[model samples]
Target: MPLIRYRTGDLGRLLTEPCGCGSQFCRLDRVKGRIAFRSALPSVYDLEELLYGMDTVLDFSARKEENKLCIQVLLAEGGTIGPVREAIEARFPDALVSVSSTLCLVSTGKQLIN
Candidate 1:
C-alpha cells in the first residue's frame, strides 16, 4: 500500500511553495529537530515492527559500549522519561530497560541499561 500523508500531532507551519521532490503534498519547512529526540521511549512491539517504525525514528541506530536493548527517541516537550520506561518494561517484561539523557557526542542515542 502507498504511504499516505497524515498529521502526526507535530504542529508546525507549512510551506506554500511546492517541494523540490515534486510532491504536491504541503511540505513543512521546519518542524522539531534533533534536540527533541533526546527523551523518546520504547513501544510494545516485536523487533520486526520496531525495525519497521525506525524509518521515522530519529537517531535509532547508534554505537554503544555496553550490550543491551537500546531504543532511540525524539520526544515532544513536557514528555516525561518515566512513562516511557514504564511502557517499555510493561511491554517487554522479560527485558531490562534503562534510560539515559542525551550525550553531546551521541546526540540522540539510546542505551537500554541492562
Candidate 2:
C-alpha cells in the first residue's frame, strides 16, 4: 500500500533523511505532546516528561484553576515530596505541586485537567 500522511495528534519533528543506523524510513524525533492538551506555558505531556525524569514521581497531572497552576502528583512508595516539589518549582516557578497517592482520570483514561 502507498504511504499516506496522517495526523497522530502528537507534536514532533520528522526527519526525512536516512538514519545513521542505515534505515531509509523517516524518523520521528521527540514527541512533545498531544495537540489537545497544549497550554500557555507547556503541555501536560511536556511536564510529565520533566517529572518522570525524577525516579520518585510515578504519575502526575497539571491544570489551571482560577489564576494558579496546580499540579497533582502520585509518587512512588517511600518517595519524598521535597525533590519533586523542587523540580517542578524550578521549572515552573509559579506552579503549586501537590502530592497524592492517586490522580483522577478522564473517561478516555488520560489524566484529567480542568
On TM-score, the candidate that comes out on top is 2
Residue 3, candidate 1: alpha-carbon lDDT = 28
Assess candidate 2 and give its TM-score to the true structure: 0.67
Residue-wise lDDT of candidate 2 within 62-100, one digit each (tens)? 677665688899999999999988888887777888998
Query: Which parts of model 1 are misplaced by more than 4 Å?
Result: 1-67, 94-114
Off by over 4 Å in 2: 1-40
TM-score of each: 0.29, 0.67
Clashing pairs in 1: 37-74
Cα distance off (Å), candidate 2, residue 61: 1.0
